[model samples]
Target: MSNEQPPSEQPPPDTASDRLLADMLGLFNRYERETAAARASQGDTNPYDLAPYEDVHGVTNEYEAARDSDDPRALDQFLDNLADGFHLEDVRALRMATAAVQAAMGRIALAARERGMSPDRIAAETGYTASRITQFIREEKQRRAAGDQ
Candidate 1:
């Protein structure tokens, strides 16, 4: 007997996954635009300063492209390209940017928790666990306390 299912029995499209992917792409695009505007306002036109921005954006664009693909070598390709195109200095700058983003995220999570949002609710929105959300809030409090000292 044939194992193939009829066309009427085909699985439904994963609208939830589609929506989530769309939202992620939108967020990335918006962040890119906002940062570009902020850089333009600051007159940050130096080629040296701009290289890192371009490199970071390239990485993100590559990531998004790879993510939407089905090839198993997407990650390998990204790594190979990164190694070929980026320097240690670029990676260090990316680390700094990552740290800044994490700090901002922690602060935002803390504010949301303080405003009575449940940890689970925050987690749902952020793709983090409830425990991680609570941890961020606690770390943010500690950071503020240390800053005040």
Candidate 2:
């Protein structure tokens, strides 16, 4: 059976998604202008002026796609390329992840000490190689030491 789709019941919602989509479209449309401006910076006098709409979705899509591929090197490259234009929330997320990893390692070391276990033994029990455990311990120790100075 054929059914005609009803028109929207109300006007479009003016939410963040709509704003971000509009910005992405604006940025996509500005590619040629950006390229000309970049070229002009290299000394072409008559080049187009770039409107410079920051595309959050473009960066996020690239970042998520790289991260989903399970390759840290690719993710690292994506981060490096993205850092200059990334939104503040992305920076906060990165900072949070760094802190969480550091805190987890600190907890493991503290728990190992409280249990009277040699870190190497703890590492073996936990499936990390002794060298990795040592490295983690030393990193936290060094950070603490530097902070004390």
Candidate 3:
């Protein structure tokens, strides 16, 4: 019997396309490793910088103006415009802005509660869940208690 292996058992020869794909995969793996290393070196610090203050301020102003109008269409339009203007780097700034707005809403809800508004009524008016409203109220009460101590 011949010593040659059967065709089905032989390995396929590498083509130029296969080499290119291998090279691309290697580069991608290297890039991912480097990114992970960099992030690890930062030790809980954010790697990306916040967006420019002017841009954040402008967006905040636009949001407030739209919200003040009390028109659903205006708010939708504002959101669409904000989405259109968003870039990858704006993530942190957007998060900060969102936190600020949430804090403001919490304060307003607490004030409304002080004025005898129930959590259910606040939730219905603000489109937030009643549980979330209650949570806000609890947090406010905790804050006041801490201040009194």
Clashes of each: 0, 0, 0
Superposition-based RMSD of candidate 2 using all C-alpha atoms, in angstroms: 16.1
Of the candidates shown, which would achieve the greatest lDDT relative to the real structure?
1
Error of 1 at 53 (Å): 4.8
Residue lDDT tens for model 2, 26-53? 7986997788879878985335532112
Identify the superior model by lDDT, candidate 2 or candidate 3: 3
What lDDT does each candidate get? 0.78, 0.69, 0.76
**Residue 121, model 2: Cα distance from true site in angstroms:** 2.0
In order of appearance, the predictions have TM-scores of 0.45, 0.29, 0.39
lDDT of 1 by residue, 43-140 (tens): 75432344534755555667778877799899788677668767988778878988897868879899998899999999998778999988998989
- Judged by TM-score, which candidate is best? 1
The order by descending TM-score is: 1, 3, 2
Question: How much does each candidate deviate from the true structure in C-alpha RMSD?
Answer: 20.0, 16.1, 17.9
Per the 3 Å backbone cut-off, how many clashing residue pairs does candidate 1 have?
Answer: 0
